[model samples]
Target chain A: MTRPTRPQSAPAEAATSATPVLELRGIRKSFGSNVVLDGIDLAVQAGEVVVLVGPSGCGKSTLLRCAIGLEQIDGGEVLLDGSVVSGAQRDQQARTRMGMVFQSYDLFPNMTVLDNVTLAPTLVRNADKAQAEERARALLARVGLAEKADAWPNTLSGGQQQRVAICRALAMDPEVLLLDEVTAALDPEMVHEVLQVVLELADEGLTMLIVTHEMSFARAIADRVVMLDGGVVVEEGGPDFFEHPQTERARAFLRTFEFHRVGR
Target chain B: MGAEFLFQGATIQRLLAGLGVTLRISLISVALSVPLGVVMGVLFTRKNRVLRAVLRVYLDFIRVMPQLVLLFLVFFGSASSLGLNFSGEVASIIVFTAWGAAELGDLVRAALEAIPQSQYDGAFALGLTSKQTFARVILPQALRSLLPPSVNLVTRIIKTTSLCMLIGVVEVVRVGQQIIDFNRFDYPMGALWTYATLALLYFVICWPLSLLSRWLEKRSSR
Candidate 1:
């Protein structure tokens, strides 16, 4: 079920062999008159964690959704590996290469935590149930939810559920994971555990495209940070982007998220 | 109207015969309609404008028309005018199915919708096709919320089947009327006793449904 992936660019193929695991070129999405994403371009390279930071309603979540094929993009193209995968027809199987965790924990309320993690592999990949369960238990134990495997999602604390959400996405064995504000709903006290799990993933070389309001976490984890404003990429750079923003738009955006104290 | 009259061997036999007919129609319609309603419910959740509009009209049509009017329309009006051949029992079954389907569809839709948007987004983000998302994520949650209301609807459908007496279907109420008609002079209060007995029978059937509904409500909430 794995198809050969095409190469993205000359340099990417030549020296680095660092083709973007997921790429979006001029992706555009509009909800009728309200254009959520207006011609955005971004890419997450292999083993890179690219955090998208912006004010609420700047379309960070929409861009993430469009990339995952949850929401259709009306303009531009999305590339998984190097193949075009945008518009009405998307390569659904290729999407398994990149997993996403939502702002809401979004764990299936009916299923046990273990079932939620193992679901996609068994159902979509047609993996053997025992194998999926074994992997699920290992992943759950990593998130400190091994005891909560058979527990309902609602029974777990917000932090545990959010960790389970990460585990669920990881169960797909995705090359690049998309995380859209996975900790936004957690209580302030509970946010650190979720971020800690993400930090560990980044350290382990899992490529990720993340949209988050946690500027400090973004600053620490992001290999590159892209600042979005009103459906457009206003600025992007290294870890220093938060402290020494290049654009007036980026500086203005970061001003509002004053909680981030990076590269002082 | 003494308690002794209710247990008379002859009265017991007639009521049992009527109960059999009532159950036959109710069971058939409930069995057919619940599955049909589930399909309609899933269809109702689709984003297609045409599907939504068509379903809205059907649900409204079924809900707004009185069962008696619908029965007459199907049996007396449409059956002969359209060259359809069916007995009163078939007509009753058709009518109750329509009623049950409409009610059950709305309940199923509501139950499905009650599932948080997060579950849907989670499924979509995982790149699950619509079918896998529903079967894996949405259905179990919907089923939990679906049962209580569905049981209540079945109870109402069973009760509503009594309307079939007007069309001469020989269900429980019709049998009660027959008992009253034949014993009108000799039994004095025969009509009163017969009607009360029929009501008691309905109560016996429906009260359990109410209890089941309450039980499900508690379980789901917990």
Candidate 2:
């Protein structure tokens, strides 16, 4: 390895619990006969940082949507703490327990950065406005946007907006966070600024399932890496999986990524 | 002679009284219509198929009929057919409210529908119920989109009150007509001067609204 991986920063949840925070069972999804995700199964333990890496159109983004109950799965069950969360009825509760950040950082344009963070608690959780605002301020400080609490989302840079998106999800105190290509939409210079915020969350022991194309960042942060191809979990293991792929498809995919890593 | 009648105390008082009646009709109709229009706008944007079709039919029905015909239908035609009892002023309120609401509702629907799906997804991802999301995220964005159009609608409704004159509510236009009739022989050019004063009064009332619409367009567009 040219660079050493960071030591495990995920919290003590793994030390105490045997159950995975998120689990996908034989998940199958397709759009009108074009199968996006064939039968696939995966599990993410509490406080485990699993990075999903694949060539484009491998169903990484769809998997995150399915996990959060945003998109319905065709066949498999998305389980949170071993309970089925496949129905639309369960989405509200599922969303509360888990948060997902999009590639575009879909922050509410009409609200300020602080209101964006506190809105759910005030409306859904009935959290006191003063308490929510105070907590939001602290979260803003954590993401290095303390001074931007009152500013609208449109005023922030792409990096700043992405970080605020992360903070917005974190404010809910969700057990696990799903990041769907959070840095893919950012400017090359701004990518690290957003990735840095994700890195801190991982270190704080927040369980996260990340879909990313940044091979280097994936290698550095993932406790386990999942490779997806043709809507299936082609292979999954530690960071070493990149250096050594057990499947022909994975080897081919990783080889192209490595060769084109310069172009990216 | 025209200038003498233009500033005459009785003539000026008659014009101001007409203006007062005009303002009252406009204000009352708006109070009734704006709320109904906002509700229509919100309902139209929602996914309820039944309500959408119903609102669509209602809006189409109102939009297709001329306001004068509606005023006559409610005030005269419906008197025996529908058995509704109201004075001309009240009838004006009813007809204008329906017309104003339809126009406003369409504006609202357009505004709400224009919001991006990403906004809805983001709001839902935050664990907000769809209602909560609408109230917090979707509605605010729609409000911004609807502002310029709303100002324009207000100006249109104010002008439309002139139609109430046909029903003898003695509003701005009809009162001006009465002034022209009273002085036609003695003042000779009284008709031209009286009508010009009416046009000026309408201008005064509607100009600020046009200015507001332009300002809102610039603010929201930016």
Candidate 3:
């Protein structure tokens, strides 16, 4: 399913040949009269973790959903690994290349944790039952929930359920993973464990797009950070976006989040 | 006292024969109605405005018209008007099927609509097409909701079978009437017992259905 993905400009291509596995250009979405995303442009290289941080209702989740083809975008294009991933069509095939973990831990409550993880693999990928189960077991083990495989999703704690959600996404072997507030619903102490699993996945070369409230975790793990306010990108930078913010908006936004004092 | 004797004499034979007809009509009508109703429900829920308007009119007509009136329309009025010579039993089946199908269709639509919109989106995100999602995910969940109402409908069908006697079908109530007619002098109280026993039999059948509805409700809630 690989395509010839040659970037246009020599310098831009050289910088990008980490070559972005996912790109969104001039993406715009609106609900009737209210526009949520206006001319947004972003890209993620292979194995990079890009965290989208924003205040509530700033349309961070909407952007992630648009990229994953869960919600249709009213304008512009989404490319997954140099292939068009959005439009009136392209839903199922595009979704197969990416996986999403919803904030509510949308694990199928009627299914066991193993079945939840294995569903996309067996159903979407057409893997046999044995292969799906095996993959589910290995991924569950990675998430530290191997023993929780046969348990119902409702029986697991929020943290464990979120981990299972991650395992479910991994089973798809997606080229890019979209995580929309995977730990927002978790108990504060439990958030670290789930974030650690995501950090580990990023380390292991998974291309990830995450929307999160945990600023410190984002600073530590993300290769890039994109700040959104009023449904538009306010800033995009590396770790220094947190250290030496570029704009007053970025500084004010960063200060609202209580980061632990490193030293005076 | 003599009524008790008549019941001991040949009441058992007649009641059994009547029971056979009751079971036969109820089972057949339910068999035809449940599936037909589910399909109708689905059709009515479609996005097409013209089709939706037609279904609304049909359902409203069915809901307002009494079953006895519909039965007469189908068995007497429509059959005769159309020059058909259908047997009383066949006519009874036709009337009940139409009645049950309409009611069942409404229940099916309610059940299907009750499924959360998220479930459909969930399946779509998994790459399942609309048909696959409906069959594998939506239908199973909808069927669970459809169960209690379906059982309730079946019980209703059983009770409604009594109305077939009015159209000259030899079902339980008609057989009871026959028993009373044959032994009026020998047993003054025989009619009371025969009618009472028929009520008792219907109660026996329907009480379990009521229990089943409760059970299914509990299961779905979990």
Which residue pairs collide, candidate 2?
A11-A205
For DockQ, candidate 2 versus 3, the one ahead is 2
Candidate 2 Cα deviation (angstroms), residue A186: 1.5
Output the TM-score of candidate 2: 0.92
Off by over 4 Å in 1: A1-17, A33-36, A259-264, B1-5, B83-85, B181-193
lDDT (C-alpha) at residue B46 in model 2: 76
Comparing 1 and 2 by lDDT, which wins? Answer: 2
After TM-score superposition, the amount by which residue A101's alpha carbon in candidate 1 deviates from its true location, in angstroms, is 0.5
The most accurate candidate by TM-score is 2
Chain A: TM-score in each model: 0.90, 0.92, 0.91
Q: Give the backbone clash total of model 1.
A: 0
How large is the C-alpha RMSD of every model relative to the true structure?
5.3, 3.1, 5.0
Candidate 3 Cα outliers beyond 4 Å, as residue runs: A1-15, A258-264, B1-10
* Model 2, span A175-244: residue lDDT tens: 8899999998999999988887788777777899999998889987788898999988889887788888
lDDT of 3 by residue, A174-204 (tens): 8988889988889998898899898878777
Model 2, runs deviating above 4 Å:
A1-17, A258-264, B48-50, B83-85
Ranking by lDDT: 2, 1, 3
Identify the CAPRI category of the predicted complex in candidate 1.
medium
